[model samples]
Target: MRQGIVRRVAEMALRIEPNRTAVLDWILHTPLPSLGMQTTFELACNGEGERVIALLNDLLLQPGDTVPRLPQSAPPALH
Candidate 1:
């Protein structure tokens, strides 16, 4: 059950990453503890969780605004 929830969440994260509002809504509405990964999910969903969502939203932007580049380079090369 826990694994299933984590898998779903991970899949949702991948889909939501490109959409800021969706990500925000998801994190807000989803039951963190119910996902069966309470410790990890709660740690991520604490007070600063919203801020993290916002930050991710900002990072998804394409130019126009200036934000420091993520330390990592291009996403890992796909096979």
Candidate 2:
């Protein structure tokens, strides 16, 4: 399910931003807790906390702009 969500979000990012490295970097790296999300990229980072922190160096992008998409497929598969 998570993988599906990620893929769908990637597709949307491709469509809307069309290969914007900063945006992708933000998506893959940003710590979402600042946006009041239940889960944070920090927690997701597990042992790689420093790397995740470094990835989130830029927080100028708003949370709304980085909302992830649901996969078009009915069932989400794990990557």
Best by lDDT: 1
What is the TM-score (0 to 1) of candidate 2? 0.34
Report the C-alpha displacement of residue 63, candidate 2, in angstroms: 20
lDDT of 2 by residue, 27-61 (tens): 56543444433222333334333332332333323
Question: What is the Cα-based lDDT of residue 65 in candidate 2?
Answer: 65
Over 1-79, each residue of candidate 1 has an lDDT whose tens digit, in order, gives 2334433443445553545555445444443332343332453644334433444445556466554332122345789
Off by over 4 Å in 1: 1-45, 64-79
Using all chains and alpha carbons, the TM-scores for the candidates as numbered come to 0.28, 0.34
lDDT of each: 0.42, 0.41
